[model samples]
Target: MPNNPPIIDVIIPANNEEQSIGHVVREIPGIVRSIVVVNNNSTDTTAEVARQAGAEVVDEPIKGYGRACLRGIAYLLNKETPPGILVFLDGDYSDYPGELEKVVAPIIHQNVDLVIGSRELGIKEPGAMTFPQVFGNWLSTRLMFVFYGVKYSDLGPFRAIKWEKLQILNMVDQNFGWTIEMQIKAAKHGLQYREIPVNYKKRIGTSKVSGTVKGTFMAGYKIILTIFKYL
Candidate 1:
């Protein structure tokens, strides 16, 4: 570890993730300074549960995943002490929050600009991912490799980025295109990045992006659209 520890913050975009948000918040490592859970117009007690679980809550009336993440970013922007490394994870409990150290290790040690936790390269529990989700990752990553000259296996949600480098990307995707937009922009900007294996399991409730037909279609379409939007 560096002599002066890095200040870290987490952002979780949640929509009706009442059953899983508490566990996700609790499982995050003690190194984190703050956990910001952006409630994306959830009808349940998602906001209350997150606040009770030790996360500072931000209400975003919009339902888009990227919108909720942006809300969290906006909250962090006003913080007195800015973070050194910023992490993004899901509120659905599919990702092992305890393994955030693994996600951010390269940034803390090797001076990497961005790190993505790849479920495809990790120990995924049975039934953790549906067929469509699997295929979409494969296609998207391949397209990225072809176009950007960078090899990436998965577009997993668990990711970390240096705070300074993140601002240069100017992320604007407001929905399913968020993750890919970051990856593509990082490559274009010549930021060093890596994908490490991360443990993944079946989530407590249905996944908003992969559980429904419409969600899957839109997410896939948006991811592909995002890959080419920069070109």
Candidate 2:
């Protein structure tokens, strides 16, 4: 491989984010070689808007977060030449696409395998996060430290990981537990990881996972179960 890496493939998992998809797509740094937006069975014009804003759209007719992410990764895996860094971001506009450098810089410039965007470590727009998300992050991170000797805060979707390293992690969480699954597996696999505070704002619409009582409970349950499954 050349000393200067060629490109970075960005995978955005989105569902019904038509209102914000266009802006998010356009905001991704121009240095990104390919932007893949996985429209996970959206009921709106998310795919169309993303395409209009210059993103390669991939259809993932799945409901879970991990399912969509896996589809995106699979696309890159089958490509002629896989990208050096794979960035994962949500389409809900909660994450700042303009800050992509911060999430991927550690991996590209410093040889880190993973970089996570920590929302709790920075300022959050009003209503950007709910009480359950805050508590869940704290409780789950505590559990990771207690059981697996790993530590992370704010399982935010904005993150980046080296392509080959991510493939080796063998991640398998299919739903709300996806973030923690990768984090715990990275710890177990001993990948060089780091976290940086990132700015987050309230999404264009209500969050499917955190806006409802049932969703919140199920997410918490799944996260706990995912951790225990590894232990």
Give the whole-model CA lDDT for all candidates, comma-separated. 0.95, 0.89
Q: Please, what is the TM-score per model?
A: 0.99, 0.96
Lowest-lDDT window of 10 residues in candidate 1?
A: 65-74
| C-alpha positional error of residue 116 in candidate 1 after TM-score superposition, expressed in Å | 0.3
Q: Could you say which candidate leads in TM-score?
A: 1
lDDT of 2 at 152: 81
lDDT per residue for candidate 2 within 84-198, as digits (tens), equals 8999999988889999987888887788998989998978998789888899999998999999886688788999999889989987777888989999999999999999999
Tens-place lDDT digits, model 1, residues 83-117: 99999999999999999998999999999999999
What is the RMSD of candidate 2? Answer: 1.6
